[model samples]
Target: MIDEVMFMRHGRTAFNLQRRLQGQIDIPLDIVGQWQVDMSGFTLAQRFYWAKVSNIARHPDRLSQPSDPPIRRSDITEYEQAPASRRRMVVVSSDLFRAQQTAHAFADPLGLDVTLDSRLRERDFGQWEGMSREEINERYPEGYASWKAHEGGEAAYGVESRPDLGKRGSSTIRSYCDDPQYMDEPTTLFVVSHGSWIAATIGNLMGLPDSQLDNLTGMRNAFWSRMEPQYTSNSVLFHLTEYDKGPDVADAVDWENGPAYLRNPDMPMWKPLI
Candidate 1:
């Protein structure tokens, strides 16, 4: 079984800065976005160190086992894995430019190949693509109102339906989980995609109710959320382990209710500098 899945949102973009609807527009990361990815990569390096350190501190006997992985610092671009460490990871990213860029940030440091998957791309915004909220409200008032009234079920002309997006999210997870390569190892998979896709994927994995689905918040740019398995007799269920990041709006998250120390005690505190 896959040990854990980490979902990370792409870094900031020109459209993100303007609060514009990206929706698979293929925007490149801006300067600040590039910096965010760089720093986030370093943070990930630190995170691995602290994760093992904490585990050792908590369970001393585990250290005596030669099979235990030795935790060591990497130069951020090339990491050497101990024989036991498997320091291995897989990065799956949306085909869009921004998402690919974000995946590269981590893949470069962790020495993992990025698997490009269109299934992980952001929802198709269609007519709303590249438009800001105010622009949508001003130019397509009726369509905007309809979308809001029906939540995501309805959308502007040519837009993909919310139900379809949900289905895609569900299928993406199912397909990846069913892959023999991933299932055979205790691999850590990093899924780099857009905000909407990430939330929808997580919600589907957790089997959250429909009403609560739309309310799930997204992580900040360059930030990540973690999920791990809860094995059951008939099947395995995944649970959110760590969350809570900056650039978030009021009250959108309800799943994890934490930047839980269980998996992410070492992550840097989120600061919305951009």
Candidate 2:
């Protein structure tokens, strides 16, 4: 059975709308970001039914292990089929307002509660916390220069280095994924973190170094990716990956700001849960 833990990027943030760093800052979602969450919720909800049915068929007998679920059939629903559903997918995010807000979009569809993890927080930018990229470039040119190049173990504005951020991000994932309860489920984990942390964690997972930071931010929000198994929970990360830019949907805020599913008129509280 494929129970994949997935991530959904929160829509544009107030900082994003304003083009600010937003590092470790608390900011809510903009109109477009709210829309992204609704869309992610719908996509995941639709995909959930089929994935559930397939898992029941493939892993007819419970394996009792957390390793990747093997493919029982190849000619299924193409790539988004059998093997995909075998892994338990969990959606998580950095504690930043934007990241948690974005994470809710995915959890909404799965009927799961998100854990607002602080260790998953974006790199603490210290002095550069709220400045826009342009402001940094025009104001603190030297620090910006070092920031864009020199990394990790060296403090930039007391900001976290690439390695430090990577370590933290990885640590957060390991802390939970290693938990007996979570691993027993064999989930495909999704983390809704920010650009800098995303870059470092993904970069290190893919074996790219500081020179490849540019490749990390290029990934779009509401987008999804995957990684091959790393053998152990601590080391297994973003290996073989897949990304979807996400679908389009009507803009909905009252639904996006918090758990509207609990109050959705068409939804019966005990129906899905029971």
Leading candidate by TM-score = 1
Q: Write the per-residue lDDT of candidate 1 for residues 103-161, one digit (tens) a residue.
A: 88866654456889999999899988999878888988888887877566345467776
Best by the lDDT measure:
1
Residue 94 displacement (Å), model 2? 2.3
In model 1, where do residues sit more than 4 Å from their true spots? 49-83, 150-153, 231-234, 246-274
Return the lDDT, model 1, position 151.
68
Clash totals for all models, in order? 0, 28
TM-score of predicted model 2?
A: 0.67
Tell me how far the alpha carbon of residue 249 in candidate 2 is from the true structure, in angstroms, after superposition. Answer: 7.2
What is the C-alpha local distance difference test score of each model? 0.69, 0.59
Worst lDDT run of 10 residues, candidate 1, spans 254-263
